[model samples]
Target: MTSTDAFNTQGNATAVTDPHTGETRYNRVPQVTWDFWLVKLLAVTVGETAADLINTSLGLGLTNTSLLMSVFLIVALVFQFAQKRYVPVYYWTTVVLVSVVGTLITDNFIDNLGWSFTPVTLSFTAALAATFAVWYMVEKTLSIHSIYTFRREAFYWLAILFTFALGTSAGDQLAEGLGVGFLMSGLMYAAVIAVIAGLFYGGLMNGILAFWLAYIITRPMGASFGDYLSQPVANGGLGLGTIVTSLIFFAAIGATVWYMTRSKDGLEVAQD
Candidate 1:
């Protein structure tokens, strides 16, 4: 914590001493933690309900909802990227906005643009692949822990946008297009995520790949479950309503973020 400490900032990405070794590392993102996953799930669950609330209940429709949420997401991302290091409020706020916009993007492709499930899914998959390919080519690493530079952060967010879009498309394909229903779709994705977790813990897969896979799948899983809880029984759901579901999850997100902000859950040192 001395002025002579090798603290540094790489183009707005803050770097801090490694504590034990005093090595500098740019860690702009939060560490992978339980609360991280918790908030992420809650945020995505809110994404589904919030989208429904705006599109159906509020009568904004798909196109208008998409446009509005996209604008909000851009604003949130502006604040997120402005931070030199990880800040829980800005980071999770951006995530919630991204989740909403990602869902809307896919919904627009289908509901508004008249695209089918197969094309939408495939397009997002291809886009996500290209993003990762270019990111790896330039950065030579795809580890979240190494998101110390602006380009890497940019790549990270772009990849996430694709994941959410891909997940929405695939989830709809499974839940509605294939007549699987939302509850079943959520269960299927949950089973797949469980297998991925097992593989990662067993060392059959590396952390980076496993993390991204789970990240991609969780989007659909959360969305599907959210729909199941919020939609009416006529629509194969519990009829809890979108407002109730959104309120529940957003409350959870607010509490988690408050705790994270007060305690600094992921960061070890007081910097950034």
Candidate 2:
């Protein structure tokens, strides 16, 4: 999940604990693995459906739902970042909250502010680029493996929020603005992601680049699939309803997180 091997959850050195403080310190994020990708996809899918459920199905509207989810995200992240190492419950909870809020951000931008998809997409892209630029300038590395400090973790979360928002807007634009069906849009993004993976595995791409690229691409792909399944048949979806779709994804995420916790498969120890 860093500039190092993408699948290297544990580093060369063993974990360290501060004897004086009796606290363990390790990477704040999880290891990049198949389950990691699985949870990410599930989270993004739930993100799409959860936003629709709260805004349209529950009649909370975009603004209120955004405010409510934003609050929940802040609280969840407060708990997550407080940990010195990866904690599945806290970290995944934050991720799910972030995904929902990211969907809301895009929705509020286009629906409430009446901004066009092109502009919204461009804005989120620029914002993400700026965050990465500043992060690299300060830390000299954008490695996910180096997220052992507050500043790097801040940059990580900020960039993640932008990715979700960007993915949501761009996916909507392709799936609706251009009259591309949601299922096809999902397939298109998935195909592109597959190409990226092929390039990475073929040793033509940097690990960090491959990881982040896949991470970003999965957003649109998962969102598109979520919409296709949750929307009405008249609207090109399978008519499962947002509630059913959300429940399905959340259950999968729960099971995956439980596995990660039990196996300790996604954590890396931080050196002293």
Candidate 3:
């Protein structure tokens, strides 16, 4: 079932509730919606372009950039976890930082260690599967709607990190390793997401399954889209350069988060 379905099934009287105690709880994450997904795509795209800008254009190198972004991610997470409930600005900022860190982690594995994309992709896939397995074993549910506890939030973030890493490796594998160009790769991933959405809306697929599937695909889609915008024309892109690409996506993400903050449109909260 989808998270909304699960929530309704448990109790339709509230925005959130403890299944065991029937006490109201608040989610620390935003509700999944069109806007949420849009911002997420922007965040991942910025992750790709911003990482390239910092590592190459700014001459920080992959290792240095990774180190710096890692520190930033830790600080972002500190503020994110400190909040008792969802705050759009804090939540999206943490997501953006996580996206950058995830890209750097994958880049380091490939460029610095000379690891093949196949192994890197496989390893991250295994890690994500393991995380889900453990999370389900402990929580008995993987519904995003149930992410009202610290432990669940931790598992949620870990899954997100792995998804970003896996997406980076898989995107690179398809575009660079397998010789597909960025635009084509982006189109391919977008097509897959469309199919998944069709299945979900058609009632042929489980909601949680569809949500996670679309989530995973968006990473590669965003990566390919970013590369297409930022790379040179000879490389089958728009030749926008990393700076321009990053700035565009960063502005998009910031605007979306600001809207969410002002409207509280996607904020997760309990209903009375």
Each candidate's lDDT (Cα)?
Answer: 0.82, 0.85, 0.85
- How do the residues 1-272 of candidate 1 rate in per-residue lDDT, one tens digit apiece? 21111111111224457678876654667777778878888888898899989999999888889889999999998998887677899999999999999999998888889999999999999999999999989987676656766788999999989998998888777777667888888899899988987886676876667778888888989998898999999999999999999999999999999998998875533232
Clashes (N, CA, C under 3 Å) per candidate: 0, 1, 1
Q: What's the CA RMSD for each of the models?
A: 6.4, 2.8, 3.4
Residue-level lDDT tens digits of model 3 in 1-272:
33353212123334767789976677788777678889989999998999999999999999999999999999998898887678898899999999999999999999999999999999999999999999999988886766777898899999999999999998888777667888889999999988987876777877777777777788889989999999999989999999999999989988888888888866666443
Poorest lDDT segment (10 consecutive residues) of candidate 2: 2-11
| lDDT by residue for model 2 (51-157), tens | 88998899988899999999999999999889988898899999989999998998888888999999999999999999999999998878676688899899999
**Better by TM-score, candidate 2 or 1:** 2
lDDT of 3 at 246: 94
**What lDDT would candidate 1 get against the real structure?**
0.82
Scored against the true structure, residue 198 in model 2 reaches a CA lDDT of 82
- For all predicted structures, in order, the TM-scores are 0.88, 0.91, 0.91
